[model samples]
Each structure stands twice: as structure tokens, then as C-alpha cells.
Target: MEESKSGTVRAVDRALDILLCFTDTTDLGLTEIAEKTGLHKSTVFRLLASLEAKGFVTRDSSTEKYKLGFRIWELSVNLSQGDDPATILLPEMERLRDILGETISLYIRDGSERIRIQAVQSKHSIRRVAPIGARLPLYVGASSKVLIAFADMNTQENMINDWKEFIDISAYKDQMAGIRKVGYATSVEEREPGVAAVSAPVFNRSHQLVAALSVSGPLNRLTLENMKDHAGLIIESANRMGNMLR
Candidate 1:
């Protein structure tokens, strides 16, 4: 019985390995999985069958290839959410998206990078997409500015002093201070051409910066003036989310 249990464990381990082979790569065929896992194609097929039955994977009939399924995303959402601020903030983000008809995103600083934790793209054909799981520089963009504006003094100085591009450091420091003073920031083509965004900081009960909530869209729709016009709305939404997070 012990030997049988060990065999079952091994089968489960191999099945997990097959699933992991799809990591970073979107789709894979049976032969590709077999080669990647060094397992027989028959074994891979059997494991995939179990994974498919449980909704952990799906197979494309046209391509005869498999991809990670909806269940994977569902599980990963929970995994990525430590304090689950995204869940707490998503409703307000959706509200902002509905009101402005622009892409709404939530970004959190991870070391020197800002990561988009959640996003709701605008329904318009000419929309800007802020893909979730994207890691961007922590020193540019409206979102990046708002985040640094609320950061600790030392961190702010360290980041600015290490500026990756040539700019007036004194003026940039003043700009960051203005963001903190006014409660929001706006940018036009600062990070990407023809893209504009406004970002506001969200704080918890302790008044610590939790994230930056932003609305981004095409330049025509979210020009500097337009982004400023949307600033009040995003600031209000960010505060609402902060209240919930607190």
C-alpha cells in the first residue's frame, strides 16, 4: 500500500511538471510537452487529460495544442493577491473606467519597478491597454511620478539621483513635490508616444502609499489638458479605494 501511495505521488509530481512546461510559453503540443518534461508522449497525454478534466488546462481543436486554462488564472489571481488589495480596489477601478471611458490601472511598486496589478481597458476602439503583470520603470509615467511623490524621502532622493535620462533634477524634484501637494499627477508622451495618463496615490489607514490608480488612453483622448480634466475623478476614486483598503 505504501509503494502504491508513492507511485501515486510520483504520478502527481510528473503531472505538475507537465503543467509547468507551459510556463512563459503560451501553448504547447503533446510532443513538445514530452520533450520538455523528458516523459513519454503517452504519459504527457494522460496527465493533460486529467488536467483538462479538472479545468486546469484546455486543448485547441484547430491547433491540437494545449494552453493553461481559466482555472490557472483564477488560482493565480488569488496567489498574486497577498493582502488582496486588488480585490478591494477593483470595484472603484471599474467605476473609474465606466465614468471616463478610459483604461484604468492599479500599480504597486516592487523594488525599483512599478507593476500593474489590475487593469480595465476602455471599450473604445482607440483605447490604450495597460496589461496586468507588466513591470515598468519606477521613475517615469504619471503613475510612477505619483508613487515616488508619496515615497519616503530617502527613496525619492535615491531614485531621482539615479535618473536614467538627462533632465533638470531640481525641476523634477519640484514636480514630484507638486504631485504630492495637489494629490495627483499627469503626463503626456513622457513614457510612450501618443499615450497620456493621470495618476493619484492611494493610501491606507496609516497613510502609507499603497498603490497608484491611473486612467490612461490615447493622446487625442487623454491629452495633457484632458488628463488634467480627469485628474479630480481619479483622485476621488483613489481615495475611495484607499478607504476600503484601510
Candidate 2:
């Protein structure tokens, strides 16, 4: 019984490791996966075959590269159906959109990225690319900062170290400090070119950051001075969203 349990645990660990490898890259060959996960190539192939049979993985017949499969999407659909934070927050976000006359977005952390779950657009002609299901780096945009501010220390440290490609940690840290002091963050051209956003964090009953809410508009319309003016309103809207979830 002890040997059987040990074998089962090892197999489960390897399966989880194989699933995680799919998240780090766009596509991976079997050899590359074996190298990354330290599994024998034959063992990896068997695991991949099992996963493919269950629709948890797919192999490119031409290139032999493995990618995440449709089952992952199907699972996400079920998860999104009930207990979605977005569904709990959208009505408040729409009210924010109408009040601020800017695009309002709701985001949550998934792994190392912030995923936009909902966006309510204002009536303005200027539109943005922050549609539902869009992903953002954890150290760049206003929403991202709200996420980092409330993440675990380890994730925060990793983001602070590796996020220079988008925004430097020094700048983000300074921004976070200010947001903590003033209860909101305002960014100019952080994620989108010629766009500015003002964001605040949404907290769960446990005071964890379940999501972030942001109002975005063109730089000309949503300048730094203008953002400072609207900071109170933005924070209030976020507080209302946070309350609804609780």
C-alpha cells in the first residue's frame, strides 16, 4: 500500500508539472518539455499522450509541438459560469462608466498575469483594446498595480524583479506607495499609448484583492491633473464594487 501510494503521488506530480509547462511558452516540443521538467523523453511522451486523449493537450501533427487543448477552455467556461467575480462587479462598473464618462474595466490575477474579465465602454468615439479576456503584465497598468499591491510577497518580489520591460520597479514602487497613501493610482500611457487610467483595488471580505477596477480614457481627456481631480470618485466607485462582492 505504501509503494502504491508513493507511485500514485509521483504520477500526479508529474502530470501537474507537464500541465504547468504549457503555461510558460506558446508551444513546446516533447524534448524541450522533457528538459524543462526533468522527465525522461519516453515518460514525457506517454504523459502527453494520456493528456491528449483527455483533450487536455494537443499536438501539432506537422511540428510535433504540444499546446494546451480545448478542455482547458471548456473548464474555464464552467468556472466562469458560477462564482465569477466579474458577474458580481459588472453593474457597479457600468455605473462607474456612466459617472466618469470613461471606459471602465474589471481585472483579476490568474497565475502571474492580470486578466481583464469585464469592460464597460463609455459613449466616446475613442476606444481601447482592453476587451474582456485580455491579459496585462503585473507591473504595468493601473489595474496591474492594484493587483501587485495586494499579492503575496513572493509574487510581488518576482514582479518587482522582472517587470522592467514594461515599467521599472522603482517607478512602480513609488506609484504603489502613493496609491497606498491616497487610496488610488493614476497612470499616464503605462499600458496603452496615448491612454491614461485611474485605478483602485477591490477587496474581498478577507481584505484580499479579488479584483481591480479602472477608468480609462485618452490622455487628452484624462490627463494627470484631471485624474487627480477624479481620484476620490474613482476610489468611491471601487469601494462600492468591493462591497457588492462581500
Candidate 3:
């Protein structure tokens, strides 16, 4: 029974190896997969057949090459939705909101925009409010800037080029350096007039930037001095969320 279990484990490993071989390359033929995985062509073919049956892979009718299928993407989306940072960090967000007496939000990068995945509204009679799933430009706002500040250089350059009319690319780049140094970002009326925010990046287990945590309120309440004072608290809360995720 132990020998049988060991064989099954090996088979599972080989199957995963076959799936992972498509990570970089777009498509692969039977011989290519076999070579990459160091598995026999017959074994590769068998594995491909099994994966194909499960909708994890597909073969092109014309090219006879295999590529990951829509089902794989569907599963990935489901997994990501299930383990969303917004759901996992709600307690931290609530704590930050309580501490700062401002609206707290969690945002994730979405192409050229950042989407508010979760939010805790402030109790004050007059407070800034952004609905959950609100999409905002990547080149503006504290949360947005935090996302851009940690993004790859190529992504930053592209975004700057895209928003050059609204922002000075060189100046933005300089600010990004400071934000990285301080481990957080602040914006005063950058996106919405009379509003100010302080934001920090949140990382996953792999240390990849996954989201931004932000506290926002009216300019009168979230003054520059107040933002500076609360920056450390926001950063600490963000770090706590990152640790939990990791």
C-alpha cells in the first residue's frame, strides 16, 4: 500500500510538472513538453489527455500544440476570489478606521486602474465615501499611487507616458522614490477636491505587492499634519495584514 501511495504521489508531481511547463512558453508540442518535463513522449501524451479531459489544457487542431485552457483561468479566478485580500484584511481595515476616524479602504491593481475591493465607512457626519468596487485611475489618489509606486519600472513608465498630460513623469518618479523609502504614500486633493488620504502597500506570502490599504477623509480632518501623524499607524496596519497573508 505504501509503494502504491508513493507511485500516486510521483504521478501527481509529474502531472504538475507538465502543467507548469506552460508557464513561460505559450504553447508546446508533445515532444517539447516531454523534453521540458524529462518525461517520455508516451507519458506526456497520457498526461495531456488526462488534463485535456479535465479542461485544464487544450490542443490546437491546426498546430497540434497544447496550451492552457479557459477552465484553468476559471479555476484561478475562483481561487483568487475565494482568498481575496479584502476579505482577509477587513479586521485590520476596521481597526485602522477606528484609529484614524476616517474611511478605510483596500484596493487592488486592475490594469490601468485600482479597484476598491473593500471599505469601512467613517462614522463622522461628513466623511469621504467610496463605494466598494469603485474603479479609480492608477495615476491619482493615495491608494492608486501606492500601487504604482511598487509596480515594475516598465509598468511605471507606461503609466507615466499614458498620464503625462495630467502628471509630470519625472516629478512622479521622484515622489515614488520617497514613498518607497517611507513605505507609504499620501495624496491631498489629488483625485477628489477637499479629500486627503494616506496609503501603504500590502504584500502577499511571496512578497508581491497585492493591494493597498488606505485611510481617507475630508481635507479639514485629514490635514497634511494629520496624515503625517497617521502614516505610521497606517503602515503598521498594512504590515500586520501582510504578515497575516504571508
Candidate 4:
């Protein structure tokens, strides 16, 4: 019985690793999956077959690559159905959107990245639009930085280590300190050229950082001075949402 349980656990771990290998990309061929998971092609194939059978993965016939299936989305939706932050924050986001005439978004931490759970588009003909369900790196963008700044020290260190290849981790110390001191953050074309954003952290009933609320748009409309001017409003909105959650 012990041996059977151990084997089952290992298989589950392998399966989860396979699923995670799809994080940075839209699809992966068998060989790519095997390389990423460090499993033999045959072993990876077997795992993929099992996952495919359970609707956890799907294969594209034309490209012969696998991608996450609808079942995974269904599970995520079900898990979030009860206390999804987006449902609670949309009204505040809309209000901010109207007040600033820019795109507003709600983001939650997911590993070393932040995922957009809600968004309201800007009214401008040219604007930044980060769609719901989009995943962005933790080391870039104002929303992502707000989440990272409020995360625990261990998480902060891990993210900085993971992203050291692309960013100077040392440069973030003062930025994060300022965010904590002022309760907000800002970015100008850090993640995408010609875009700028301001963000504030939101907390839950227990005073835990749960999400970030951000206002973003084209650089022309979201210039440094304008973003600084709107920072207080964004922080106020985030505080109100945090109170509502509590």
C-alpha cells in the first residue's frame, strides 16, 4: 500500500510539472515538453496521453502541439466562483476608469507573475489594453511591481533571483521601499514601449496583500506628471476596495 501511494504521488507530481511547462508559451510539442519536464519522450507521451484523456490538455491537429484544455479553465473558474476578487472590484475599477479616462486593471499574484483578473478599457482611440486572463512577469510593469512589493520577503527574494537575468535586482530596492512607504507604484514603458501605469496594493480582511489595482494607457496620456497626479486617486480606490473586501 505504501509503495502504491508513493508511485501515485510521483505520477501526480510529474503530471503537474508537465502542466506547468506550458506557462510561458501557448503550446508545446512532445519533444519540447519532454525536454522541459526532463522526462523521456516515451514517459512524457504517456503522461500527455493520461492528461489528454482527462481533458486537462488538448492537442492541435495541425501543429501537433499540446495546449491547456478547457477543463483547466473550468476548474479555475469554479474555484474562483465564490470569492473572485474581480467581481468585488469591478465597480471600483469602472469608477476609476471613468474618472481617469484610462484603462484600469485588477491583478493577482501567480508564482513569479501577475495575472489580470479584471480590466476596463480606456476611452482613447489609442490605449493600453491588457485583457482579462493575461499573465505578465513580476519584474516589470506597475501592477506587477505593486504585488511583488507587498509580497513576503522570501517571495521577493525568489522573484528577484529568478529575474536577475533580465533586470538589475539591486535597482528595485529603493523602488519597492518607496512603494511601501507611499502605498503605490508607477512604471513608464518598462514592460511595453509607449505605455505607462500607476498601481496600488489592495488588501483582504486580514490585511494581507491580495491584489493590485492599476490605471494604464498610452504614454502620451499617461505621462509621468499625469500618473503622479492620479496616484492618490488610485490609492484611494484600492483602499476602498480593500475595505469592502474586509
Give the number of the best model, judged by lDDT.
4
Clashes of 4: 0
Q: Which scores greater on TM-score, model 3 or model 4?
A: 4
Clashes of each: 0, 0, 0, 0
Q: Of the pair 1 and 2, which is ahead by lDDT?
A: 1
Cα miss at 174, model 4 (Å)? 3.5
Cα lDDT tens digits for candidate 3, 1-246: 222355666767888899989755779999999999999999899989999999999999899999998888888666754466777899888888887889999999889988898999999999988688677888888898899899888987888789978988889899999999999999988988899999999987778898999999899999899999998888889889998884
Clashes of 1: 0
| Best model per TM-score | 4
List runs of model 1 lying over 4 Å from the truth. 1-82, 164-166
lDDT of each: 0.87, 0.81, 0.88, 0.88
Q: What is the C-alpha RMSD of each candidate to the true structure, in Å?
A: 6.7, 5.4, 12.3, 3.8
Cα lDDT, model 2, residue 74:
90
TM for every model, in the order presented, reads 0.71, 0.67, 0.66, 0.77
| Winner by TM-score between candidate 3 and candidate 1 | 1
State candidate 1's TM-score: 0.71
Mind giving the per-residue lDDT tens digits that candidate 2 earns over 1-246? 223355666766887799988654769999999999999999999989999999999999999999999998999777754567788778888887788888989888887788888898888887654667776777678888878876777877787777667666787778777777877777788767899998888887677788888889899989899888888888888777767765
Ten-residue region with minimum lDDT total, candidate 4: 1-10
Model 4 lDDT on a 0 to 1 scale: 0.88
Per-residue CA lDDT of model 1 for 85-167, tens digit only, reads 87778888888899999999999998888999899989999999777878898778999998899999998888888884755
